[model samples]
Target: MFSLRARDAMSASWAVSLLSKSLTGFSFWIVGTGAASAHVKWFCAYDAAGQPRGLENVLCRDFELLLGVALLWFFSGCVVERTSLGELLVRSINRVTEGLRLHTEVMIRAVCGFFFISLWAVGGIILTPELKTTSPQVGLLQLAIAAGLLSRRTMPFSAAGIVVLFGLAVRDYGTFHLADYPIFLGLAAYLALTGLQKDLFGVPPLDVVRYATAVTLMWASVEKWAYPEWSFPLLIEHPGITLGFDNEFYMRAAGMVEFTLAFALAWTPLVRRVAAAMLLGMFISACFEFGWLDVIGHSGIIVVLVAILADDRPREAEYRAPWLAPAGLCAALTVTLFTYYVGHAAMFNTSIL
Candidate 1:
């Protein structure tokens, strides 16, 4: 009996050692190969030792930390999912979703649509080097704009974000730029103005936004994995990989994080707020990096306005800002066109301009 027990113990120890090696090897492979890893390098781990300490470094550090937190959150999710309680909660949530009404579904879909749009922005960052060349002025200016929109009760941030996106598309025509200022600001502003901010706050169905975002992110992630060339590997080697986390591995991991968070929030409200904060943090970082501080300011203003108006439970009449809303939206559109012209004038000149 004693001899048999000793042999079993020895076998178990060997098995554990082998498992450890396998895990380490797997991690290395995940980070060392592809566009996600390259994205990770640009946004999370890029070296900036000799660079001047200004808005640029601050922006880089924030993104690096953001990526690191996302990675940690991903690992923590694995632990959570492995628990019995997590399994139970997940099944219960699925049941709830199955029973939701059409209105609830529409609201969910809208939120999700925005989230996927954000993913496209992130993907653009990884795949297009030109976006990586964004100037600090641009980032800060956007941030300011986002903040302002977020604080405005009558503004639609989603519309604003779309407008901003149009601006960016114009600014860098033919280049894939993943700027989120336009979308986030636009969506948030819309919610604030439409009285929906109060309608959904503290409700169980509020998770529709996150769930929708997650679904899009999950598919996007699969596509990234399926097409490794267009993934992080190509991105990392691109001349524009500026941030540490701008590598293929990291970008993939970020996508994974977004996907996981979206699902996790669907299961638990606790994580929903965290996910929102992460999204906001990313936007803030972008504002500084491109000197698009206006985006940050405008987006933030809209959010605040929504929060205040929501708490006050103001009448629909008070919430409606007919003139300003359209004006802000038109202004956003004009800026987008101007920026696009600046970014693509060269190409246009080469072709037909």
Candidate 2:
């Protein structure tokens, strides 16, 4: 009794119903089979205690305490600057440091080539979260840049391009947020500057690389103390990495080890090579447990650390450190880390003691 059009509509509806059911079954199969696993995180953990997290906010409870301790550390630095011991230590360090060699145009070009590969092909394989969503845009630009930067003459354009990307990252992720991973952006911009002229605004590029790496280490290390539970899964999976210690002790010791290395990296180039070597080992060790994403997450740092090793500049000047400089540094580290652990614990209801 139905017309031909009515018969056709009923048949089409039946097909759609079958297709929908099939997709739902496939989704269940994919999830239930352990096909899609979790990734190592790029973002720092948030403070979700009370209020809602708005998109624009950079200050979670943990970072706010981080800022407070930093202010105290800065104040301590100001006090130390006025001491004769500080000047003595500085001169000693200046002498001991194998100050960076001025790069030849050839060397700068080489570094750019590696960075270009990092951005284009490797990045094409797996884009880092830090790269924003514009991989194609960034990759094509890097291709042109590598050609231009073959000599030091075209550095200005590279610098400008880096600046634009820096701005984009800041716009997307607030500059102050730890989760934003701002150090890489800062380092990329600084590396661009290093290619332009004799010195990086009177500072060495290696120094910036080391210092930036140190900052990143210290920043992330605190999270381990603050939210040790986040690392609980790793402990569960690989108990051997704990090396026979109880889990709680292992976490605290691990956090301290990271903090100490980071603190050492910033204190003196005297001990930096040792610290960098240790950090490199730790990064590689972490890669075994977390998988390739850990390596990708830290690749930028690994490149810079390698460059730090390749630097063989010798130092002619050395200074004697009065007892005060080392004492002050030790004191600063102790206070900052102690407060960092307790502050985070207080904020998030984790135990510090």
Task: Name the regions of candidate 2 deviating beyond 4 angstroms.
Answer: 1-40, 43-127, 130-149, 178-182, 316-328, 331-353
Query: What value does the lDDT take at residue 277 in candidate 1?
Result: 41
TM-score of 1: 0.33
Off by over 4 Å in 1: 1-153, 157-197, 200-216, 231-258, 271-353
Best by TM-score: 2
| lDDT scores in order | 0.37, 0.51
Q: Model 1's lDDT to the true fold?
A: 0.37
| Residue 316 CA displacement from its true place in model 1, Å | 29
Per-residue accuracy of model 2 over 211-261 as CA lDDT, tens digit each? 777766666655555555655666676676655545544454454456555
Taking all chains together, each candidate's TM-score versus the true structure is 0.33, 0.58
